[model samples]
Target chain A: MKTAVSAPPARRPGGPAGRRRPGGGLSGRLGPLGVAAVAVAALLVLAALLAPVLAPYEPDIGSIVQRYLPPGPEHLLGTDQSGRDLLSRLLYGARTSLLGAAAVVVIAGVGGTLLALVATWFGGRVDAFIGRVLDLLFAFPNLLLAIIVVAVFGTGMAQATVALAMAYVPYTARVLRSVALRERRLPYVQAAELQGLSGVTVSGRHLLPNIAPQILTGAAINFGYAMIDLAALSFLGLGVQPPTADWGLMVSQGQDSLLQGYPQQSLLAGTCIVVAVAAFSVIGERLGGRAAGGRA
Target chain B: MNDDVKGTDGGVIGRAGGGSRRTAGAGGSGGSGAKGPGGAGGSGGNVIEISGLCKRFVTGRGSGRRTVDALDDVSLTVADGSCLAVVGESGSGKSTLARILVGLEAADAGEVVLAGRPVARRPRRAERRARARDIQMVFQDPNGSLNRRRTAGSAISEVLAAHHRVTGAEARRRVEELLEQVGLRPAHARSLPGELSGGQRQRVAIARALAAEPRVLVLDEAVAALDVSVQAQVLNLLSEIRRDRRLTYLFITHDLSVVRQVSEEVVVMRQGRIVERGSTTQVLDDPQHPYTRLLRDSAPRPGWRPVRAIGRDAAEVEA
Candidate 1:
């Protein structure tokens, strides 16, 4: 209790980076799963970018002589009904599924986050108006909305992507708006305002950073949803057209010959969708834990 | 959960009564002569006036516990450019009163007039912010008070950049100015609150309070949690700041000895009411109320050796 007459108020209790020590830290536990997902994602990207090189045989290449041959060193997972190489189509198909999902997430995350921020920040009439519009969009079943969008634009990569983005953007916007509203009331935000920050500055600088973790987690979850939606649309024939090898279209093409005992084509397509969604879900779960822990 | 250390000399300086032959000189330090323009210079009268301030929180739905009155008609006025210390124990309505002053909590019924303007019940956001800028607060528990994610310079510059419209280099320069003013080195600019010591964080908190260039500073137990040594330094810094900048202080604390050292006027509060009010010398040395006398008696006094009672009369007096 012998108080020093002139003590400075600061005491650096720990060294720099007080919250975290360097090295992998908690991410160490998540590294393998994270790496696996990332590796899959990378392979998907590479296959998409270098589809010509990675594909063992030309996707459309076939021979009546080679057709119906199953799983051999020479044939390699065999040939499809149209004499196409199943392995080549599978490799090429990863590119389409991943790229389509990425496009959908980017568009939806950015557009939805911005819309939500505006609606929440402005509040009152603006908030009510945006909320109603989003509710209207949410009223439609996600696949149904995507289908209507695909039908309107006609089937293609771009049209499929737009349909998925439009379908999920409302969900993202509504969640982000709720998050922004909560951030708007924090003492630090009030402190920010008292310092003379403009509303736009506060919303962009303060609201955005606080809501980022939530948005990122939401985006990951949405990515999984978009993959399912995109696959369904493709399955319906309003997705990536034939010649371009997409997983969903591949599944559709293989369905008719199910009774003939050639099930590998449909199985390959279904596995792609399942793996992609699982990867995103696991990574999302890990990220969500990290985000929650970081907050605490 | 924390021990209440009542050791006489822990940090209390110069016991309350009869000990200081130098006490008379110390008493004259802050008034009259100190009122000279060169001495303290900032001694305007009644900058903030509170009349019948009362606050009650209604918790639960329908029939529940009785309404808890946080402030029971608390009335006090802070002299312009002078430190007014409001001393109270825990649950004494001190923090509630402080919050009401800063507009963080709305009072149930009362009036707070700052610099002659009646405080609006619900001021417009811009006006409230401006008012907040004018009457800044320094919270206790510096670590909990600051936003953990923000860097020191960003936190300080935010106030300047946000309210003053100065950004980029100009804002950075102002942040440096504020940091330097609060006794922190410019190198602290990029450091986060978590990077700094408790004392350093408090300094940053002070720097943040000063960012708005407030005329009235409401320190809500600002130094209560610091080490005794650090508390002294912060108190001295507060004194210097008050003197140099001519800032008015609404200094709230639980330590009577701390109240004696820094504050010119002292208002003693207990259970949401001001039990005693006067100049520090008048109240501490010659308390009129029984509660004030009890507090003073309970306050620690070091270096005065207690003599063994001479007989039955002394024993009865001790009892």
Candidate 2:
């Protein structure tokens, strides 16, 4: 009995709140690089939202006479082979690119989270079945799955986005399921169960809230992956078809001008994709780090 | 071995004798009446009667699989309104017994009759809720028992709302009453589990269990995580609550000293079976089984020296 008293205290002195010493809000926890990532992401989103007002020329109505023009005062960032104002096209392209990626994240995040919650909450055979299904989904590469969907659905943004979302579901579900499994075994969950709270009630009120950080982290990371996959599909001419002013479409359409020693259009659009993907990746990684630190 | 099994009945008689020995002031309540001979069949019947409970866990697969008997034919009875301590070292299957009784784990074989109704092997939602109202559990770790996001008041009120129809202001009132009953300040209800100390958090856990107004409370190592001083305080609180409400307890712990402090009857377990059991004084003071004696001798006392003979005692007990 005295030896039991001498046993090390299982609990840390301060609770989880005390251990999470980083600043409270997202901005406060972010370092210089994370802040820059947030700034770039915010600026791109703002630019996308204000495309009509910000662009000097109509994205779709290009002047053929100005085609392949080098970067100059009249044609900022030069003109594509179709003579569409590259700056205006890129600005408008941000909108479709961002929106397509957002749609994929929302679909995959909700779908994956739901699958994870069901698998974890029911456990047993339900969990095993869902696990096998997710494993099957995981076997397909994201681009291959998206291309397959595009082929079947006849080439569209919605089809490609939905397919990529499906491909990403296994990743999110697997991560969330592992975290939720741990949370499910905690005493509070068992206490709720012992209260005879319905499975839905326990899951919604207890399980989800506890695993909210992991879900957010998963969403942030998936957002970056979704953007890249959707762009890849568009570049392949399997998504957001011609004349949509999408960055990937611009890159593909500018391929002809690249052979004419006018690389401005493809280069600018490719740079946009790289910058935007980097921004999201940085923010997502930071969020994942913070979530891990908070848990520890 | 058969004689030891018969000693359980002897424990009831010893409890009856011990009940009379209690001070008239303390025994004035239903304590004496509840311990009367044949109480098992009377109005103060066994609230929790578990028999032949068994649970096995298999690890690995096929060729490498190993089966562990977590609980092997474990049996015990807790008289209504009495505290029966289940004492053992780690892996003695005491915790398994509590889990099975609380419906958290399924037994491979056995029956658990709680408040006169045999528990369902696989209870439905309604039956689970009914069982919740009949019995509640206070776990060992205070940090893990309550949701950190929820306020202490909300945790207790949630249980009350689940087991009873009370809601809104009525629920709030009951929450406060329950918190106060567990020696927590009414203001503490607004605080989260993370904002409280280990001992205070445990009080909230106890209050949450009491909110269900359960007839039986299975406390699984309830105070093993606390400091020695806090352990005494929580133990006192548990005893007072039991006395005031006449709630039965299945106090499970590895600490023998705690067993003496909080229990009237105790069942000593070794590996998945009960090695010995009787009134607390009879078993602790005059332990008949070698394992029980080893457990008693292992507990540190004033001027007690460390002994390296545990292996010898274990071998003796095995024989």
Candidate 3:
């Protein structure tokens, strides 16, 4: 027994907070999937950022003479019915789609995370009230909800983004609340309470960190949903409006040229939407997996 | 032959006798000899003082169900630097009292004065945490008490970081020291709780409690799950730590024989109330409470025959 006391090694190698080797834990398991997702998202972001410098012709600089040009060196993906370069429009359209999805993710993640924490933390009447309110919001289909807001607020990127965020908030809040309620019952929560950590500290430090992966996963899934919904609305002329080079608007233009044998407009726009959603879905799945694995 | 396993049948008294023999071995094996944290001699105040403590747990929500009187009007004090065993059968409230005294569960009524201050009254957040730092607790099941998500090193370091105000390199050094102190190699820090055996995990748990430099340690059936031999070793380490650190301990257990060996004083609880309290000899050798007698009589003895089932000739002598 006396020897046991003296046996402790003098030099410990790790940090106090469980120093994870850079990208250790779940990242190790998620290696291939994470790399694939990052590579795709990075490509999209870079393409969107360099659209102006990379595009051969301005998306809106249409010419009647060159209109409906077939795929060639000068018009890589060919031109829409108006002779605007389809490649340029698709590249710039990424900026709008990615940005709209990002805004929706941020607004919904932060707003819904806070709301659900408050609901779960206070519980009783507060939780019941939020539950009912979320149920009411969930009743509306998100695209229809966004269309009504776009229809009501007169159609702009800001209004469409706001409408999409509101639609996604209920989903974010519901997921967050489920995780928070589960964490609230852990032994450490009671330990924290006994230690007198305030409700804020308990929720913020313990609850939020534990639930972030789930929320982020939900955000990723919602981002995909939001991107598709935004495009669909734009296709219906209720999003981004004309001359904005949105994928949905391109799809609408493509519909007009379908009889003329030019399928690039819809095909390129449809491909962009599919790729963006897939990028976010991959990232979301990896994050949610890590969260469930309980690795920081 | 494996020496310890060969010697496993020893009763509590035999284990203590065998433990003394091991201490003699320590003299020969101190190759990298250094004084460990729970250095071997000190004694001194009531490190834990409880008076009229009562805790009740409400059962089965909203059916007007009866509340479990987990602890009923229990008053006990542990001397500084001594192990006081609390023994009782399951649901007899032994663990409940330990939990309440450590502030894991609040007492429905009464006072738990630890190292001189009341454990009730809801101290400010920082102060309560500070108070908790002085009185650390270790639970029965090593697997359940520890957080499976964290590595053993991080698990130990968390308590140090929370209460010691140490950070970065200093905290890391201390955590390694703690890991080493608990008889595990420092390299074991990276291993998750799942990889460790039952005994090793308990050692880590003890190391975590030790990190706070607690004045009073509460062991809620701390060695109950270990094999008999490992249990003896842990008990010895605990006693060694208590003596060296001048630490006070409320050792909760259901085993009367184990209690008799570790504690100077023992408190036997029954139906949420303490039925007997006295020196180990006074309680074990001459139990006044009928419950304590039953507990003592029921405890398995290696070479004893039942008095009730003898032949008529032997039975007639009893009559």
lDDT of 1 by residue, A121-166 (tens): 7686999999999999999998898888888889888998998898
For residues B142-218, what per-residue lDDT tens digits would candidate 2 score against the true structure? Answer: 88888877778888988999988974767777877888898877767677676788999999999999998887899
lDDT of 3 by residue, B128-235 (tens): 687776687887877665555556777666677777677566776788788877778877776666667788889888888888777778888889999989899888
Pick by TM-score: which candidate is best? 2
Minimum summed lDDT over a 10-residue window in model 3 chain A is located at: A6-15
- Top candidate on DockQ is 2
Query: What is residue B69's positional error in candidate 2, in angstroms?
Result: 0.8
RMSD of each: 10.4, 8.0, 10.8
lDDT of 2 at A4: 30
> Model 3, A34-95: lDDT tens per residue?
77877898999999999998878887878888888989988888988888999999988889
Candidate 2 per-residue lDDT over residues A17-59, each given as its tens digit: 3343322677766678999999999999999999999999999
Cα-based lDDT at residue B130, candidate 2:
89
Q: TM-score each candidate.
A: 0.72, 0.90, 0.71
Candidate 3 structure, TM-score to reference: 0.71
Candidate-wise lDDT, in order: 0.73, 0.81, 0.73
Clashing pairs in 3: A8-B180, A8-B181
Which sections of candidate 1 miss by over 4 Å?
Answer: A1-29, A56-77, A111-187, A236-244, B1-44, B51-58, B61-74, B87-93, B103-111, B163-173, B254-258, B268-276, B280-319
Best by lDDT: 2
